[model samples]
Target: MSKITNLLAGLGGAIALNVIHESLKKKSKETPRVDLLGEEALQKTVEYFGGEIEDEKTLYKATLAGDILSNAMYYSMIGNGAPQHLWLRAISYGVAAGVGAITLPEPLGLDPEPVAKTKTSQALTVGYYVAGALVTAGILRAVARKKE
Candidate 1:
């Protein structure tokens, strides 16, 4: 794939993941979803780089930056021809996301420890990650076909 295609796929994947994850979060909580994930990203980013949360806007922007990076990581693999098989690509992407899901949230204070987290939460997070990957892979494939 072309570099532009890769970047676009990455962006699409990022947007898909955010939409899926946040939409689900909205259904489960009364608080703002962006604020939740954004705060987590902000806290982690600031502590790692030495700073403070500042504001909700800052948090959201930080969160978006992180999301872009994460999606880029996933789509980059495909861009480099990691796997042509859609399901395999999805599995790989999902595994990456799952590892992050299980480990990162607690340190960022977004959730309890994995063992302490409810099964529903675990399942939903994982499902969203895999679904997001599938969405990206599917869209990329469709776009590739259209170009042919």
Candidate 2:
């Protein structure tokens, strides 16, 4: 029971942290744009490879491709808007929760055995959350650089 409680606490903490990080990212205003020229270049390359885009459809296709790639790049960099980030954040919180469950102590009025176990769990859980945060931030930074 103590383990479960500890795990829950750790997970909760991680989730809160992720939310804060996302808010910070949004506050910074990382904007995303569609690169029409890039799409045109890609279309030309495809044509060179014997895949021709008819003139009437070329503009439409280029715009569609540009929008897709631009959105992908934007989402990857601005993870606050990406579903993958939410999933990752959840996983990170779960890990922290599991650790907390094992290491964190229960409340002062609670049993000592549970408390000790919770403490151990929490220690590991916090570590996992920290690692997750670093990894997420690094990924976002890499995506931003790619856009540049």
Candidate 3:
């Protein structure tokens, strides 16, 4: 892929991830729901660095920005040269992000505990990330087929 195509691929992945993630969060009431990876990441990151957010609005915006940036980076990472197995890629992405999602917050004092409260919740939590990756891969594949 050309550089522009590569960049568009990343953006496509980001859009797919965000849309799926948000939708799953809204639709699923399963125990270990992931409501705010970006928000938690931002909060924990700031706290880890010993910074304070001035207010809720600022924090909210920062969280959204963080989420967008993360999706771009992650999808770009996968699209740049990762394997072609979308399911495998999704599992890997889910595991890596899932671990960080659960572990990073409390150590940084951002939350009382990991967001997932039970086993099913935990699985579903990771599943959402996998679903996002699937969405990304599906979008990329569809576009490629359309081009052909």
Candidate 4:
């Protein structure tokens, strides 16, 4: 029962994190564009990058790439890919397991010491999360470039 509960909690945490991340990204996309730098400033950037402001397509692609990168960074920091998030989830699971171990009688009379070793589980979860994030970021970047 405790193992099942922990699994459900972990799944819930991951889903919640993903939802929050997607919501933030959507909100960011809806933000009004602020041209802090005037046309002259933009022209300077174009010149520096050895590109001319030719068409709206190119500008749109650049804007999309910037947004994707920003989103990737933000998600990587606050989402499941980070060690802090993993540790937090692990602690949650640990507490749940602890409660079960104490409240429910164990037929096998198993000790909770093994269950308390959450570091390995946390590390594995974090590693997978980071790997998935990197892969998704790469895909987004490639798609953005292709769209350009």
Candidate 2 or 1, higher lDDT: 1
Prediction-by-prediction clash tally:
0, 18, 1, 0
- Candidate 2 lDDT tens digits, 8-69: 33333334444443344223222111122234445666677999666756665665545444
Model 1 residue runs over 4 Å out of place are 29-38, 104-116
| Residue-level lDDT tens digits of model 1 in 1-148 | 7777777776777777777766666575332243355556568767788877878786777777787676766764555564457658766777667567666767756644322256666666666667767776776788878988
Measured with C-alpha atoms, the lDDT of residue 43 in candidate 3 is 69
lDDT of candidate model 1 versus the reference: 0.65
Candidate 4 per-residue C-alpha lDDT over 1-148 given as tens digits, one digit per residue, 9 for 90 to 100: 1233333333443433334333443243332121211222344567789977766666655644443443344333322344335445444433443244333323434332322235443333333334334443333334435666
Tell me the lDDT of candidate 4.
Answer: 0.38
Candidate 4 clashing pairs, residues 3+ apart or interchain: none
Give the Å error, residue 145, model 1.
Answer: 1.2
| Sequence-dependent TM-score of model 4 | 0.27
- For each candidate, C-alpha RMSD in Å? 3.6, 21.9, 3.4, 21.2
26-135 per-residue lDDT for model 3 (tens digits): 45455443445456667667877998786988987776666766766675554444436654765576577766666666776556233565666676656655665665
| Root-mean-square deviation of Cα positions for candidate 3 versus the true structure, in angstroms | 3.4
What TM-score, over all chains together, does every model reach?
0.75, 0.26, 0.69, 0.27
